[model samples]
Target: MAQVLEFRLPDLGEGLTEAEIVRWLVAVGDVVEVDQPVVEVETAKAMVEVPCPYGGVVTARFGEEGTELPVGAPLLTVAVGAAATGTTTGNGSSGGMPSAPAAGTPGTAAESSGNVLVGYGTGAPAARRRRVRPTASAPAARVAPADEPAGAAEARVAADIADDTEQSGPVPVISPLVRRLAREYGLDLRQLSGSGPDGLILRADVEYAMRAAGAAAPAAPAAPAPAAVPGPAPRPPAVPTPTAAPVPAAPAAERIPLRGVRGTMADKLSRSRSEIPDATCWVDADATELLAARAAMNAAGGPKISLIALLARICVAALARHPELNATVDTAAREIVRLRDVHIGFAAQTGRGLVVPVVKDAHRRSAESLTGEFARLTEAAREGRLSPAELTGGTFTLNNYGVFGVDGSTPIINHPEAAMLGVGRIVPKPWVHQGELAVRQVVQLSLTFDHRVCDGGTAGGFLRYVADCVEQPAILLRSL
Candidate 1:
């Protein structure tokens, strides 16, 4: 008999709690290999293809396309092992089906891939499913009892496995959010009976425990407690009061949920605004020399150098001179953490939303290498294939909003990072050059720095250095 296993959505790291099923790769009755990509899911960070850890025939899928599911929610089920076979005679007589594989029987193929996400799947072989004995009055069915509803047998078997897990090992909790909730309330997960499939602890279980604990707590003192005791008392139920006649109901408005990449951007921007006291300093630069230099380099080069690559090179040089701006504020430690590596992130707007893909070890990369990396990351971002690792750990962000045909913006600092450099569109403008008014390629550059990290002097110097490089590309060669 095949051992049916339900696969839950694995934790797609970086603190993501849930994902929207963008697409499913398998259907009911389809055979799947271990570690095969089963579904495409869109999380807050990026689009990811979740793999199934079992090799088997798919039995069911839990959610439809565009349906959002939490980290621990079931994604699908697979029936592992070989199916029981039987022979029948033409005379209405039948040979009995072969007995199911015995528990831990040698030569019996294992069912799991042993590959899984964090906090999921034990490395040990899957627990052997108990064989059901037939009653005197009832005949043994091939897969399940005739009267049992679809999936009911699977549920029972899963629950049995869960019971064994709960008794012998760690609590069956897959979601970090659920664990965090329990931790916050000082609730013992082992003490509470899980309400999720296979006795898996869920966020709801933790929340219910918290509510129960709150209800069972002793009433607060008659008056406010001393300041040492934190948290305000629970408000008493409000008394009824006379009110005016009920107003007519308003029409429902179309409300877009802040979720996926959009939601992540909103949260990060909001957090950056709330936590960082930021200041912006901007200046217009004569980029005519920079453009000519890039054109010249490309004309003679093996690999063409991009304008942004040149700008990035200049930024890296500027940062080396002003390392204070290339640092982050550590509020808890009361210190400014200067990062040694320059993993520069550049803002890219995709079909999904705005994203910042970081170029790791940027300080060590050449202009040609930076151009190649930026191209690769931008392409990945457009295709929604950029991983969470590619999207984070940015020590500083270089945003060229000039692509949007804008002059400049007070770019918000990508949080935990100390600063952001925004570049506006480089356009032809008349400027005083060599004692004469000449039309030059000019661009506006803005530096947004966390006030806690550095003051205006450092920020201005960094911007000034970048502007000088753009005005005279030779200045950047000195650092090179």
Candidate 2:
């Protein structure tokens, strides 16, 4: 008999709790190999392919595409062992699961993947999976029916376990959704006992508590019971006040849900606005020389140097002088974290949404290398294949809004990072060249920096240095 093993959604890291299934790579009755990506999920950060650790015939899948599943929810069930090799229901039916798979074949008891996601694998410690069966008194702690939605089942379990479990030690909560729910309602997790195994707090527990509190609230003081029985014949039973007529409901407007990449961008931009006191300083530079320099380099070089890469090189040089702009504000520690490596992120707009893909160790790369990385990341962004790791850990961002045909924009700083350099269109404009009127290639450069990190003087200096480098590309040679 094939023993079926359940695979839960592993933690995708970056503190993400839930993910919406965008596409299912494997279907029930399909044989899968260990470390094979079975599903593509979109989290708040990026689109990720979730690889299953067990190699076997997929017996059943949990959520359909577009369904948001919480962390630790069962993603699918796989039947392992030699018994699964030749057995397939004629109509591709998923039979009942027997016992756990014994070590026989790949994806069986002995063979499982070493990598599923961060901090998760088939080889996880047995202590993490240990469970004690609920006693008769805890009748509510039964397993959810197969057909029940995971959220609903979890909520039900949580509500039932809240009253039965004793609370202690770090408030056994694993789901980020539960934490968010408790936070939104201002419920302290420490005060409530969880209704999950090992006293784990669940969403239902919070909802139950909220409902109980609402039901227990005093009801309008019973309208004061009409005071005196002998009040002048009860004042003719006092005419009741007229109630307002019900108004017709307004037509519902189309609402785009703030979830996935767009949702994450909204949150990050909002946080950047609310938390960081930012300041923008812009300067127009004559880039005629810079353009000529790039052209000359490309003519003599083995690899074509991109304009953005040159700008990135300029940014690296400028940051070397102004390290304050290459750091983040550590609010909790009350310190400024100056990063040693320059991982520059550039804004890339894709079909999914606007995403900033970071080029790691950008300062160490030549203009040619930076150009290649930027192209690779851009392609990945457009294809919706960027990982969360690629989407984060940026020290500074270079936003070339020029490609959009825009002259200038006060770009929002990609949050946590102290500053961003915005490059506008490098158009030919009439200007005084060498004290003579001429048409020069001019571009507007703007720098938005966290005011908490530096004052206007430092920001102005950084922007000024960048503008200088753009006007005279030779100025970058000193730093190089």
**Location of the lowest summed lDDT over 10 successive residues in candidate 2:** 115-124
lDDT of each: 0.76, 0.76
Please state every model's RMSD to the true fold in angstroms.
19.1, 17.1
lDDT by residue (1-480, candidate 2, tens digit) is 224578899999999999999999987655667678999999988898998877655657899998999999999987543323333343343332212332244664234322111111112133443322222222122333569787885576455334323342223443434554555555555556554333444556667766665565556655556556554553357688999999999878977888899989999999999999988989899999999999999999698999999999999999999999999988999999899999999999988889999999999999999999999999999999898999999999999999999989998899999999999999999999989999999999999989988999999999999999999999988987
lDDT of 1 by residue, 1-480 (tens): 324578999889999899999999876545567778999999999999998877645657899998999999999976543322333334222222122333254443222223111122222222521212212222222233559875775465455445545565435454434554555566655565554333444555666667766666667679867667568987999999989999999868877888899899999999999999999999999999898998898899599888888888988999999999889988899999998889999999999899999999999999999999999999999999999999999998999999999998998899989999999999999999999999999999999999888889999999999999999999977998
Relative to the unseen true structure, what is the C-alpha lDDT of residue 197 in candidate 2, on a scale of 0 to 100? 35
**Candidate 1 least-lDDT 10 residues:** 109-118
Candidate 1 regions with alpha-carbon error over 4 angstroms: 83-252
Q: What is the lDDT of residue 438 in candidate 1?
A: 95
